[model samples]
Target chain A: MLTAQVLYGLTACVIVALGLRGALLHASLLQRVVAINVMGAGVFMLLIAVAYRGPGLPPDPLPHALVLTGIVVAVSATALALALARRLHAEQDND
Target chain B: MNTTNLLVFDGLLLFSIVGLAWASLATTDERRSVILFMAFGLVLAVAWGRLLAPDVALAEAAIGAGLSGALLLAAVRKQSPGSSHTHANPDRNYSESGAKVVLQWLVTLLCAALAGTLAWALLHALSSAPHDTLPRAISDNLVASGVSNPVTAVLLNFRAYDTLLELAVLLTAVLGIFSLGQTTPGYQPAGPVFDGLVRWLVPVLILTAGYLLWVGAHAPGGAFQAGATLAAAGVVLRLTGRSRIGLPDGFVLRIIMAAGVGVFLLVGLTLLLLGRPFLGYPPAWAGALILLIETAAMLSIAATLLLAFVGGQPQSTAVNAAANRQREENSRC
Candidate 1:
């Protein structure tokens, strides 16, 4: 069971790598946005996966709350990024 | 099949999550990638649940899957007419694509090696960090706090400073969005059928948001979840054209967006003045004070999210009339 938990952490690590690959090699800005978000999700998984030791324990509430805060921050950042993209698109349309 | 074999389920879920993310990011079609991204968000909710953080699962589903998906769709749609993707030409650049394929392989190898090292450390090494240390402290102090939920206590009590800064961060993002563009139109009004659906859904959403906020003190819900739920309702109304997305700049709008931080400042300062060390409320009054802070936070979060999505103030009356005309014509067809 602990090995399963470690596997989950490894999966998260892979997800982050996939995201980094997308962010770097992709030509599209939208793809980069998607990639960055995927990386954020992996970070979340890693944090929670590490905190979760076994089934019956109370689990770490600190990371849960921190993840919640992080999610909100991530959304705020996403909104700003999308707005920037939208502005650029509109300008291109006008031209 | 052993019904309680959670490890099996966990393995499957991790596979699907990684696969879905890969498809979403690797696909070339803009619309299809976004659709896959939305599915990825829902899977994220399930993953958080498996991790035993239902509070996060709820927030993730609403904000991550629901709102973010809708926001991305709207942004994509805004560029529908003669759209220009970042990679404007593909077939013309065969050599460029070939070079990119080589670079991709190298990056993948590097990332895999890094992940393997971390996995080994987590499983075999990394000793002596002390388990249950902070948890003991939190539980020891939990009774004195008004709420029994450890997570809620920590967020609003022990580490209130972090939550306070998060509220400010949300505010700053909204303001940064406003500076990006002034005339960007917010939402598109679909047909009357969809409009009817939105009308029926809005009230139910508002009620649920309130219930979630009230339940957060001792349950797996809180201001972020409640606020995100409320923001989803506002987004629906905007899409239906029943609500204004780009309502003009005014006194009311400004105050509502900044209200969360304002209330946080007042609460913390009041506690400091009372000689209880900033944000340290009286033992007996902590519960009531947290409830109050959460209520303001919920309202402010909803308003801030709406503004951030809209990006800027409404355009002139003439532009509004043109949009209305366009909607009417599209619906007729």
Candidate 2:
């Protein structure tokens, strides 16, 4: 159980780093948006790993619930960001 | 499965998840990148299941992987190919300068350091004795929480304020999208075959959404999942060139958009007036109250998500006129 938890946790850390690198280096708004979502997914993986107890035992429900809430919020934020990006592109077109 | 098998499975899953995330961001092509990101979300959903979070896995598959992909794809489709504005400004040559390369290295190192620090912190936290206080309290109080599913209990009862706030955030997001501009002109109508498929598919999706909402009290489903499924039906309609996409006009649309937060706040405030703490439901009433709130939330979430996918304020008057013309033509036929 511990082995699995540590493995997922470490992998999540690496994924977060990759996402951060992409977010910072990528110039496009869409790539930045994707990068940010990736970062969020990594964070969520870490939380789920922490919530895990073993193969059979029921895990922590708090983190599971929190992550569920986070998923919906992430989508909403993505929608808003895409809308803003579209608006920006339209404005640039008029100029 | 046994420990070794589980270990191997976890290893493979995490590897693919990381690889997919890396590949998605590595490309500069918008459509390809978004498609890869969607794949990443699906793989991540499987990982969530492997970690024993079925509720979260369901949500991730539905909202994270499914709806997010749809929204991103729509945005990509709308981008006018002639305008290089939305694309990354790849025209600027960064490789020509030594300082720029140095800055890139610094940024990479900084991100690596951040990852290292986080991993170190996680290792320490995991090594320590796990905190069982809250979980124990939750278990002790589970019977009175009015739901068999602990995650749903937490979402609708123990930490309902958080869910309430989340609905507000969703409301705010849709409003922002509305303020941006009008929705794109809808798709060309589906052909006879697709039209036949949608005729049956939409009803099935709506039924599944209802089942999900009802089953949430005992299983790995809830308002969020149900709402997303419902919104997907709307998306299918919009994609098939339905002008109104099943949404009501003007005042009713705004009401549906506001329903989640409005109903939640009203319930919380009413409980406060009854001399209980905010959202503190009496055990006998808790189940009923959660059902009421979840129903309203599901509607709002569905409307808001569909509206978000539409990408802006849907022109009600124009859509109504178009629908009326279609109706006249059908009557004549």
Candidate 3:
């Protein structure tokens, strides 16, 4: 159980790192959007991990709600980012 | 499973999630990355289940994998490679200078440090912090809160404010997409087979989404999940050329997009003016209010999510109409 908890927490950390690296290193706007979302997922994992009480206890609902809110926020953010990407590409075409 | 087996399985699940996420982000092929991202969402849905959040797991599967994946895929389909303005900009040419490499290293270090701190906080906070028992309070009031499911109760009753703001946020994203710039020519795959598949699937999709919404009162189904399911259907419709990018013209479009937030605010304010708290439904009216709100929210969420995939509304529906006319002409020929 402790291993489950620690492994997930560390996975979150690695995911955040990988995503941040992608966001920084990638040139394409779409890639950046995807990276940022992965980073968001990492944060969500961490939030959910904290909600996991040891052994028999049910996980916390508040964090679940918070993560749900985060998911919605993420979709919208992706939408906006993709929209911006589309516009950027169109602008380049015109030029 | 023994504890050892459980740990190994958990480790593997975490591995797949992190691995998929990395593969999605690290890939040079945009389309492959988007596809991998979808798979990542599905795996994470399982992780949510492992965490014992069925509501979230349901939501993650529908919204994260299904709708979000389609949206990203549509965005991917809309663009031609190397078209973005950044391609022309010198800033993207990071290989030209020694200074740039140094700066890159600095940024990488900073981000890694940020991730490290977050992990440390996660590890320490759980062991040290006196986390309050919020579930007890929620369970204590579950009957009067007007929902049997604790998650639903938290979403629609006790923390109704969060849900209200959430709907507003969805609307805001739709508005942002609308205000951004333009919707590219929509992707309507041309084929009789595609059309037949879409026709067969849409009604089933609608039924499933509605069933999910209705069951949300006592189970893992709810407005967000239902809405995303509907949005997934809309995505299919949009892709198959049955539905256009943006819906009917701007006026109806605005109304549909605004419906969720508009009704939610109205109901919440009505309660406040009637000497109750904002978002406080009368005990007898809770189920009715939730159902009504969820219905409105499902529509609004579906429309907004579909529009978000579409990217933006045009000045008129005429653009889609013209495309339809062209498609008809091609079919006739």
Off by over 4 Å in 2: B81-87, B93-96, B318-333
Task: Give per-model TM-scores.
Answer: 0.89, 0.94, 0.89
lDDT of 2 at B129: 93
Task: Residues B112-147, candidate 2: write the lDDT tens digits.
Answer: 999999999999999999999988888888899888
Instruction: Output the better candidate (2/3) by DockQ.
Output: 2
* Root-mean-square deviation of every model: 4.3, 4.9, 4.4
CAPRI-style class, candidate 3? medium
Q: lDDT by residue for model 3 over B1-333, one digit each (tens)?
A: 688887888988998998899789766777888899999999999998887788888888888887778877777777753453213235674556899888878878988898888778777875675466787787788888667777888888888888888888888887878887656564547599888987888888889999999998888888888888888777787777654533567678778788888888888999999999889888899988988888898889888888887677754667667757865775676
| Model 3 clashing residue pairs (backbone) | none
For candidate 3 chain B, the 10 contiguous residues with the lowest summed lDDT are B81-90
Ranking by lDDT: 2, 3, 1
DockQ for each numbered candidate:
0.65, 0.79, 0.65
Question: lDDT values of the candidates?
Answer: 0.79, 0.90, 0.80
Query: Fraction of reference contacts reproduced per prediction?
Result: 0.69, 0.84, 0.70
